[model samples]
Target: MSQRDLAKHLGVSLGGVNYCVKALIDIGWIKAGNFARNEDKRVYAYLLTPKGIAEKAALTARFLRRKMDEYDALKAEIEQLQAELAADGR
Candidate 1:
């Protein structure tokens, strides 16, 4: 997305998006290039590099695992509480 679009989507300031994008570029995780347009002569576009794609996939997996773990724990706790309530009612 454009920097402004990223900022809005991320709930951050435009300048913060610019700074983070610059850092991503420097880290070689993302590539940046100029836009070829009349009014956007100096504007840039960005895309993830191979490394960045892999990192994103890995992070997504980690997030999914963590979320699953949270869900399972909640489920177990609820079941235990339900069992206790049943026992108390007997």
Candidate 2:
């Protein structure tokens, strides 16, 4: 997606999107290519490198694990509250 589109989707400023994209390119996680066919010479496409794919997978795994931990904590809290209510004969 274009940086403007990305900024809108993320609810962030255009400058923030540009900064992040530049950082990603600098880190070799993604590569930016010019689209000369487009009427606008400023148009470019960002493609993920192989390393980027691996990094994304790792990040996904970490996010899922964190969510699961949160779910378990919430479930435990709910069970504790239920037990307290039962003991109080509510």
Best by lDDT: 2
Regions of model 2 farther than 4 Å from truth:
none
The digit string of per-residue lDDT tens for model 1 on 1-90 reads 678988999899999988988899898889988867658676776889998899899999999999999999999999999999999994
* Model 2 global lDDT (CA atoms, 0 to 1): 0.95
Candidate 2 local lDDT, 1-90, one digit each (tens): 788988999999999999999999999999999987889999998999999999999999999999999999999999999999999998
For model 1, name the residue pairs that clash.
Answer: none
List per-prediction Cα lDDT, in the order shown. 0.89, 0.95
| Runs of candidate 1 exceeding 4 Å displacement | 37-39
Candidate 1 TM-score versus the reference: 0.83
